[model samples]
Target: MTSRDTVTDPLPSGRGAALPDGGGVPASPPIPPRLLTDLIDSAVRDHGERRAIDFLGRRWTYAEIGALVDRAAAGLQAMGVGPDVRFGLCLPNTPYFVILYFAALRCGATIVNFNPLYVEHELRHQIRDSGTTVMAVIDVASIHAKVAAVAEESGLEKIIVCPLADILPTFTSLLYRLFKRSEIARWPADARHMAFGDLTRANPASFKPVAVTPDDVAVLQYTGGTTGVPKGAMLTHANLTANSHQMTLHVGHGAEANDRIMGVLPMFHVFALTTVLNFSVDTAAEMILLPRFELKQFLKTVKRTRPTKLLAVPTMLTALNKAAASQDVHFDDLDFVVSGGAPLPFDVRQEFERVTGARVVEGYGLSETSPILTCNPITGVVKDNSAGPPFPGTTLEIRSLDDPHRIMPQGERGEVCARGPQVMKGYWNKPEETEKVFVDGAIRTGDVGYLDEDGYLFLVDRIKDVIICGGYNVYPRVIEEALYEHPAILEAVVIGVKDDYRGQAPKAFVVLRPGQSASTAEIAEFLKTRLSKIELPREIEIRQSLPKTLIGKLSKKELVAEEAKKAAG
Candidate 1:
């Protein structure tokens, strides 16, 4: 039952050539097939008395949360959620997500995370693709409506509605229900709907522990693949737990109940799911949850909680860097900040650290790699424009872009490939697509980057046109496809444009059909229903003709260069 039990068929050493200090990648023994639930169990046993989560004015300790998970797991089992069951959680940051995530896994059900901002169209594709039968959603009107609309037509059968005011402080709950009652969605008392209170009231004695293993799929995190379509990465229990181990090792150890992690990123996102949620449970740190990040509220919470750690993306650092100069925010309590999910700019890091006195380090990985592989040393040398070195138990190499089979020399720009226990098994139900991403037993990252002599990874360019807006991946193809739906559009091309606020945002260029015309505002209004706010293009430029390749295929390279020139001007 120990955490370090041995595992067989270890990940290979994909490191092509050794560098100084063994390429700054620490060596470790074989990675064990560890279960994700084991991590929370261990934290509960060790730090049961410590505070585990804080949302709004409410809080729960590890022991209290563990008991809730037990009862919830029993209720889920009674609802026919067990082995081979796929449970979807479409919720924002709340205690319900924290409890249900582990509870569903404890019931031997595969967890499928959904973004609360998804429109009905996006929800339908994922539900059908992943075969999610039972779903947990917040009772907010728009969010619940989207799921309910898809439930009847899609494979989804049951919906577990969690209320927002249920976990709020008693007085706050009354005020929320009284004033914000219109936000609540109404559903009938039928077989398809269940309340959170009912889900958590089952007798703990009836909870039969299912026999779970490490290799079983734990979570289905969807990310845009090489084709710009969202695909679920089948993360095994071993993959997730090992990544937690690797993250804990990278962050180093701290005193018991010492750190409070600031979690502003969406819990459904892979980076925050691993770093903010799992990492806190692994270290027994108190997690201060914010439903969404607002500059005023974030600083207010920081002042109140005095958190020691902050898990952030580049845009967040950019905002804080600007706020620290004028606002009365004090970041003295922040020990360090780990920036991931998007590339962290050099000046953003330098300015933030200079003003706040907190060491901000950049990290890199994809959802397919349990969301983390390389991070700069916390208190050690941090190179500019580098994603630091590979974590222990992970091997990263630069493979030639043209030939996935060939590994490139050191400092050569090529696609980044990685192999480790933290890597997912493959895409769910897509064997043909899965086969194309792995070469020589390593996951092809589809990013053009090189490793320095010290083994630090530098991402030069992305092979895919995925725009990272405010730390979330926004696919250009998704936006382009949406634009083509307009009758007036004959040709469409989308590219990532630099923005001062969001690191990058999608920008659309379209050519109107002969004798047909559509205004930018008109096209934008059309896209509101088809695309999420983040997926919407910031600018839609109508043109007589869009740049095309020799074969008349829509091209984006010329558009990208033009944007760069304008930005320079």
Candidate 2:
């Protein structure tokens, strides 16, 4: 199959307005009902000799990765991981993660992503919640201990330990294992635990792919629940496949086949999973993986690889801008950069583009909508501060917060709702909660945003993140944006805290730029002219750094929890 053969334009022009180029949003043709694993198979067939992944100094060709995937799939089958079985993947962005992820899907098992940093308590909740019996985890000491604890608490039957050195060359693996022996977790010599190397040695390459339909569950992506217990969003094969097509349509051939795409963000994130892993595989692009984001190391890799596309978060961009301000960091080779996970500050975007000469555009998505709903067109006009237009087949409407059924007028701030082929089936095992979010056919994205006349979408803030000060709704994002305008402020997050009179009030946590200093009163004084009294943060706390989610979005939840704990104390 050719590059264009995997997807096509199926919708008519009437679905949306025309673009600046006198064309409607590129419509994705009916995505063929195919398993997510098919992307890897196609990549191997088309670019087998090309390097599929680059990790550390090691490079794995598409053909080599495909063989490993087959071996891992067969090994999983021998271990009883078949269709309908929940296979949990708790590894980070490593070669093991790539191989096992596809291998598990090839076995028709639902992939459940877990943050490797989670403690025992957190692991138990997710393990029990997803009913994952078999899990693949990194063989580091800290993570392994937590997984073992979860296994002891839950009915975790099999644990496949993927060592950091397992995938390295023989000499390097031996050196790494010897030097890093203290960091490696040796799970008690037992039958319940198996090394990834031993598992692959089974080499069941003859195992056949399981037959599955479009509706079959592909992954159970868990969301950071604000209202109640964390629930998994059930994304089907159809949902992910359509999103791959939608993104391709939105970007419009900017991502060429065999282009080097940077994978700095964790693949476990839905945003990175779609954009970095699945999308690159579908397009037969070479993916350069960074186990985690380290500004210095990332720049070094970029200089070496000369990646064409970067799928990054706002925080990474902010860091890059700061680094570039001090000295030259080559980024001119980057064809395009898509920033998601959080809102990209206007200043950061400007500086990044000025230094790197790469077009930086923002996109919006949630785990439930198979992640991507809107992205500024790569080949077309990008409006300032807008997340751009809806993906080809997606229909986005701004609805009244009071009544989700009441659709608001264009350019109105309200709850952003979306309906499309990419939307998930529902929240896993939570029919009632799913009913609450899905009104009619649209998924009520708890976010507050407006759509322009030309169909570009601009986000304001999340409804849950809104601060109520003296009976008035205050959006923290508005205050945060003002704080970002301050030259000294490097990172800022606003959260609602308990108040004696107002019931709740907004408080800002800020991180200053290196060698920069600012007093809380000075910040408040600066913002006084920019914001109304009630909208301004009542309290500002200066810190060395602010908390971040696994994907690096500012974690207002952690700040809120910290405030709550302080109040309790």
Q: For candidate 2, what's the RMSD?
A: 11.1
TM-score, model 2 to reference = 0.79
Off by over 4 Å in 1: 1-8, 11-26, 254-257
Output the lDDT of residue 94, model 2.
89
Question: Which lDDT values do the candidates have, in the order given?
Answer: 0.86, 0.80
Error of 2 at 168 (Å): 3.4
Per-model tally of clashing residue pairs: 0, 3
Cα lDDT of candidate 1 equals 0.86
Candidate 1 per-residue lDDT, tens place, 1-569, comes to 12234322444233222222212354465566678888789878988999989998589999999999999999999999998999999999999999999999999999999999999999999999999999999999999999999898998989999999888889999999999999988988999999999988899789888999887889999998777888999988888888887877777784354689998899999999998888898888899999998999899988888889999998888888889888767777888999998888889999998998889999999999998989999978899999989987777878777877677878888898887778888899998888888876678888889888888999999887688898888988898889889999988888999998889988998989999977899999999999999999899898888888999888888998999999999
TM-score of each: 0.96, 0.79
Q: Report the number of backbone clashes for model 1.
A: 0
Q: Per-residue lDDT for 33-69 in model 2, tens only?
A: 5678878888888778888898876899999999999
As a whole number from 0 to 100, the lDDT of residue 295 in candidate 1 is 91
